[model samples]
Target chain A: MIQISVDEQACNGCGLCVKDCPMNVFEMGSGVSIPRRPENCMGCLSCHEICPAQALEHQGVVPSRRMYISSRVCSMLNRVI
Target chain B: MTKSFIEESQQNFQHDLMFRVEDVPLKCNPPAAELEQTLHGLMQMNGYIIRSLEEIAGRGANAVTFRAGKKFGHEVAKYFQKKDNVEEALRELSYILYGQYSFEPWKPADKDHYIVEENGSTFIYLVFHDCIVRQTLRRIGQEQSGPLCQTLCGYVVGAIEEITGRRAKLEIVHTGPNACLKKVILK
Candidate 1:
């Protein structure tokens, strides 16, 4: 089981994580990002791949925890991805 | 709007942590009781979010507004988060600023100017009219609203003050092709 944590400080309220999660693990409030379906996260790492702010992290997982690029970098890395 | 959003966040996300960075003498600064009146007055002017434990930096200060986590651009690059990404963003941002890279806005008129100051420690993006318009690639997440802008500005200003140990100012010049200005004086 992966424990997902969303860093409020780093989140710029972009809402991309809310959309990228296939499990519907994230929610959007006004402009901020919130974790709604954390349990639903299948460890697919889709949200991890799409997160632009590097705000979301999986704590419980062992070795090689997954991370994602921020939205700002997404614009730059879109071509490579 | 920034102020309102902060309030809403505090009320809604009771579990989440909120931080405010302010530039005031570490100890010489007035106590919260004294600053309350000033903060209250500033609140009336729109877009003010003051949280407890506003880390006060002392003396002359000016620097970059560094933000990490999910919402800011750092998540994308993870440079600051990972040191290497910071170097890369600086390289790209620098190249673009010096007219070396071909990175230009899709709309010629909607040019978003990026400013790198304090030896690349601070990156200031003067996103003008174009930022006000939402992009097709991002529909639900585009930062087009006024409140978000104000909040971003306030947060940046506060963070800059904290990072540099002084008050920071951001000037939003109305240089849009179709722009109108209304001036108000604080008496």
Candidate 2:
């Protein structure tokens, strides 16, 4: 079960997420982006990543654990950060 | 009117280019049963190696996995070099990848929408509706599988290069938990 929310205050209805989503999960309405088909969301995070305003919120979506980042790499990144 | 010799030859060539694994030669000419068993075993080993490498190398594992996938694709192209057309070779390759490697039921994007042709250039669009890598990532609650997807890119590019004797470009156009679309352009 994927839950998607749009921040009307931040979203300018750019529709980038609507265009970027392969599943057609977002729709533009009243100059704002809406999660019209939240049920079809695959939790790919493409919308979240593409939203310039960072106005989209996804809940109940399990984060992917396929990161190949090892502890050594994380330590190095930690030091850099 | 009788068909011209060139037209007849073209038809014959198309017929010969039909996708068939049997057309691919094996180093050891194994029987069908034995070949399937060998492929299954090889895939199992591949999965193990990928997992182990991901665990060992961490961030660098994707490069290794990409190279491995490219090598695998090159090997397949070497075995099936009848026609040098990139589209035909890739279509056949997709059949094998989806039929063999997918852990869940797979549905291909509509063919009419899958291919884009313009100005004598060919672009193939593929959507993996249910990828094993994404499934694994989701199950484990990890946020980064971009590297894993790179393996597919390498494999497709390698196969295209080997088949057409020319390099091709691959782009990950869109990715989702349930679907990802990859675009391969023949250059």
The numbered model that scores best in lDDT is 2
Docking quality tier of model 1: incorrect
Alpha-carbon runs more than 4 Å astray in model 1: A62-81, B1-187
Candidate 2 per-residue lDDT, tens place, B93-158, comes to: 665466333321112322344456678767776555545555445434454345566677777677
Superposed model 2: Cα runs more than 4 Å off:
A1-25, A31-81, B1-60, B101-121
Chain A TM-score for predicted structure 1: 0.65
TM-score of chain B of each: 0.23, 0.54
lDDT of 2 by residue, A1-81 (tens): 679999999998899999988778888899999998877665668789778999999998655433222455567999999
lDDT of candidate 1 over B1-187, digit per residue (tens): 2568778888887765455576444584677446644543443332222111112321111111222111233222223222223224334433322321111211112234334345425444332222211121122232122333333334434333333333444443222111111111111
* Best model number under TM-score: 2
Predicted complex 2: CAPRI docking category: incorrect
lDDT of each: 0.39, 0.66
Q: Judging by DockQ against the true structure, name the best candidate.
A: 2
